[model samples]
Target: MSSTAAFYLLSTLGGYLVTSFLLLKYPTLLHQRKKQRFLSKHISHRGGAGENLENTMAAFQHPPGLPVYGIFQARTMEWIAIPFSRGVISAVTIGTDMLELDCHITKDEQVVVSHDENLKRSTGINVNISDLKYCELPPYLGKLDVSFQKACQCEGKDNRIPLLKEVFEAFPNTPINIDIKVNNNLLIKKVSELVKQYRREHITVWGNASYEIVEKCYKENSEIPILFSLQRVLLILGLFFTGLLPFVPIREQFFEIPMPSIILKLKEPHTMSRSQKFLIWLSDILLMRKALFDHLTARGIQVYIWVLNEEQEYKRAFDLGATGVMTDYPTKLKDFLHNFSE
Candidate 1:
């Protein structure tokens, strides 16, 4: 090649590389603004443990004395209930702007409400909800564990599960956050159909930790918004530390995560090791930084941390700019918010 041509080619390649590096290094320069449809200040985890039932109508019948959002579990053709009663209606009646639920597909292609695919934890049965037909599913434990206490027993009147359609039929206006716990085409299709039938595209959100599932959910219904996958969350975290969050185009509209979950080793009397405590501390500093939360909120992404029922934790979550805090005790949250405001 001639010297002149070589010089021009080198300059063009160098310019392209420089531009790319700048964009990656300073993602805030390319921020694409979006309008957030929903903003929740309080989200109840498992419909809030009252009367000892996590997702039962008996529990939900007792409102939190104020307007607070709630999260429920969806299983295969069954709503969350106690042993032999109807509890699906409880979620809609709780008077929250948004209701979050976990969805799983049954062998019969039925989309139901449930948190765990395996029925062992919530229900005494050892079968997977997906493996069993609608009739084969068992009832929930009479006494379920509360979020705050390790082994507290509460009892509710309704124990029978309800169908997913039942919830839609009951609460047409309320927005719902569907957490796709199982990655299945049938489950996705069913959820999409329900959302469409209920005309709730603008109000519902698709939540899954898996990127693949998030993609499928979008493909199934592009109208509904989706939560960021774990990969994107981590990527955002990395970008936050590098100060590139302001320049990037953020597609995720919401972040739903635990404050700081430490899985203790399997043994009696589980406790966090020193390393675990350190990790939690590090996460608090990095993830809960006010600057990070402010940046995301400015970009219209909502931050929601879960399973926090204590007064101090609630204070911390909001102090860090959390749009919403999920709790297992609605009454406690209500009281806290009321007193905090006072």
Candidate 2:
């Protein structure tokens, strides 16, 4: 090959490598396991009794002994730090000890908080967020249509598509749990980088997918913990791993051993059929929390569940033993925890 031809080839390969490197470091995953190992110190030998960030020690709101702290899904109308911060404030004031938030990557590669994949579903814009620039992303957040009163009332305020750094600065010491609703597998490295940037080891990265992405996040960002989502786990076990659960994969010496920090979500009822129920009788007996409690806690792993409603359910989960429950109504969960003690 001629010298000019070789130069072009080298340049092309170099560009690809640079792009790949940038994506992996978004949340800024540093290999500082010693600094950010939140679980190792807190979780009981069985992965329970993890403490709270703001008010109580654990998610359980009532004092130290009563279990169950509320894990809430907060929305950011402005993409600014205040919106995310306010959610934590609200959760705290209303008796909540813990809170949850959703994360996604913008076209410019900034990590932003958003519950929906497309802006259209929540804001009526027919575009994937991955296609828009940071400035372009802010225009839609101008007027949120949510009727929930709390978020809707704050519609006219200035909230930008927040950079992860903003959130870190606002809730520096406060503990938070983040849900990775988007399937941008490439963002794992970026998430690690940004996480290391603020040195916010208190935050936990969550997903439903299996061992692969979770392990990547944990390995890269040694300080931050991870949580697994229901769909992600099912996909890993049924199709990818061929019925073998997390430990089996790890024991087999697969590099994809399950991340010890994160917990698995169980399949919901609607997803199950009668025929399948008999085959997986054990699953039919346990809802996501029950199953996660039985599976993870027993193995000394921490687990988290999703959107549980009702006061009775909260008491039952704590009674049965769960590392955490992701709730849409943190205010309600807080109220429930308060009354249980009174």
Candidate 3:
């Protein structure tokens, strides 16, 4: 209540405001630019689920069940009788800069590429991925529904579940974003070992939204880049709003997040309660700040908005200074990016 105390308080508040504004406008002032090994502006969600069966070999490479002839088999009449399949396009061929997929641990400690822990939705089998060995895994349903796009189904010739190592061998050069769906130490260890074995430490990004999982992943292999966990993201939003973001040292390299508006659209306003809709709208307003995005980019962090399927959503993400847009429809996104002027 003293005049001197009030004066000091006002001075401190003014100084903090000025510092926050300057840092928001120019984040490089405090943080050194981080060196990124791989940059992607077009990320395929679930290996372009809308274009092919999600996370299947057909989604990422050649159709499964195709036989390779050995040098001796080349002389066999069976090689000549085999028919060649056409019109099967892979996600890499569709011009996706990065592939976004999830991982789960099989019963035999193998890492498989899948989004859900349960196989009912994708494979139509009521079993946990961890309960089955890699070979015991069932084939995917003839027609699986796309997660992001409701009521839309995608069918492909290759319905077999693929091992993570197989995907690495198939697409060694492509950058991949791996989401650890569960808090399994063995799964994390296996994925880390695979990354090291494949020498893809620079090109692979792996983490889970759970802080515990992310920490374990980093401890397993600190060289590989990590996506922000849910706790870190919440802390980041808090710091950004409190004008203390610049003072903080961000360790994560990628900020992969969902666009709130797109999420709201997916939830369908008619189906949401008034309070749910309002919270989503409020999150949209708070998280969509271009200044926050620009500051993160300036700090050498790539911001990727995920699961955006439509062209308009892609345009919105790019317009808001997103580093990339992850979508279920890679072909559609490729076309949009091709025709995009900016």
Candidate 4:
């Protein structure tokens, strides 16, 4: 505890604090901004699930003269008969900046765009997607409940499951965010191959929150941008609180996270147990740090908050420096963005 030793210690601490503050405020001083090919502010969750059937071809575009049968025979025929020359309403037609969908592998090794691994919730079939062949897969329920927005139901003309390759062919130029629902290596490999075959490396982003799954995806194709895994997210938060985020290098280009406030509001607060409510509150406090978001944005990392269907939630996300908002109701979000100022 000599005077000279104490003086040097204090000087070092002061220098570290000053450097950390500067880096926090201006991240580009140390880290170069990453150049991303596609940036989206309005991302459609499950191809605008609230508006359509949730990841059906009909949700993405008007089905071209496809024959209709069963319950949709009368209703679907009217919409399906419309010529492609005439403008039709769909998720793509409505102008979503990006499509956020989940992927699961069929028994035949084909990649399908779906939100659930089990078919019961979406299709009312008691089977896992992995156990069925592409042809054996059941159709989605005609009237489906939206996951993010409770009690809300959506209907679409085409309820058949769509292959990932089909989506790529249909929307060649659109950006897609694929969430790998399982740890299946084959699923990851197939998705990567499709992205490569379509030459959509720049516009397509894929990954799961599992660290192991994210690592496999990166290994499969490092060219495609990956989303942050849960472990990495925790690590980043740690670095931010420790004032070391500026000194660290970030490889993932996209950070897709949920808005905690939205979660609290989605389920009735009175219905939640005290512990559940406290956890949500804790997440709100930890994850809604404006300084952390600003630093990440400065480093050219796009931050997207998820499943925010309301206008106020969208405003909060943007005000917190989020680059994008993923919503089940893309049309609602688009309108909000249109009328929103600043």
Clash count for candidate 4 is 0
lDDT of 4: 0.85
Task: Please give the distance, in angstroms, between residue 140's alpha carbon in candidate 1 and its true position after superposition.
Answer: 0.8
Per-residue lDDT of candidate 1, residues 1-342 (tens digit):
999999999999887666645654443456654687767776666556643366544443442332222332221222233232333434434434455667787788777777778988778888898888877778787777664545555655456555677667766766667889978888899999988988888778886999999999988888899998888888988976665555667777888776763222222334657777778768766777777776777667788887676677888888888888777765456556655666
Q: Order the candidates by lDDT, highest first.
A: 4, 3, 1, 2
Q: Which stretches of candidate 2 lie over 4 Å from their true place?
A: 1-90, 138-161, 183-186, 229-284, 288-295, 298-300
Model 4 C-alpha lDDT per residue in residues 1-342, reported as the tens digit of each score: 999999999999999989999999998888899997978999988887776789887767633332221111222222222234444555555658898889999999999999899999888989999999999999998889888887788777788999999999988999999999999999999999999999999899999889999999999999999999999999999999898888999999998898887777679868999999889889988998889998998999999999897777888999999999998776567667766752
What are the lDDT scores of the predictions, listed in order? 0.68, 0.44, 0.84, 0.85
Report the C-alpha lDDT of model 2 over 1-342, residue by residue, as the tens digit: 999999999998887566434422321232211232333111110011122221111222222222233343222211111122122232344443344545678777877765555877445678877888766873334334322112222122223345555655655654556556555666666766777777765554444344465566666665665555445455434532232332232111011112221121234557767766565654533343343344444444545443454344455555655655544345455545555556
Better of 2 and 4 by lDDT: 4
**lDDT measured at residue 308 in model 1 versus the true structure, 0 to 100:** 79
The predictions' CA RMSDs to the true structure, in order, are 8.7, 17.0, 8.2, 6.2
Angstrom error of the Cα, residue 158, model 2: value is: 7.3
* Candidate 3 local lDDT, 168-188, one digit each (tens): 998899999999999999999
Collision pairs in model 4: none
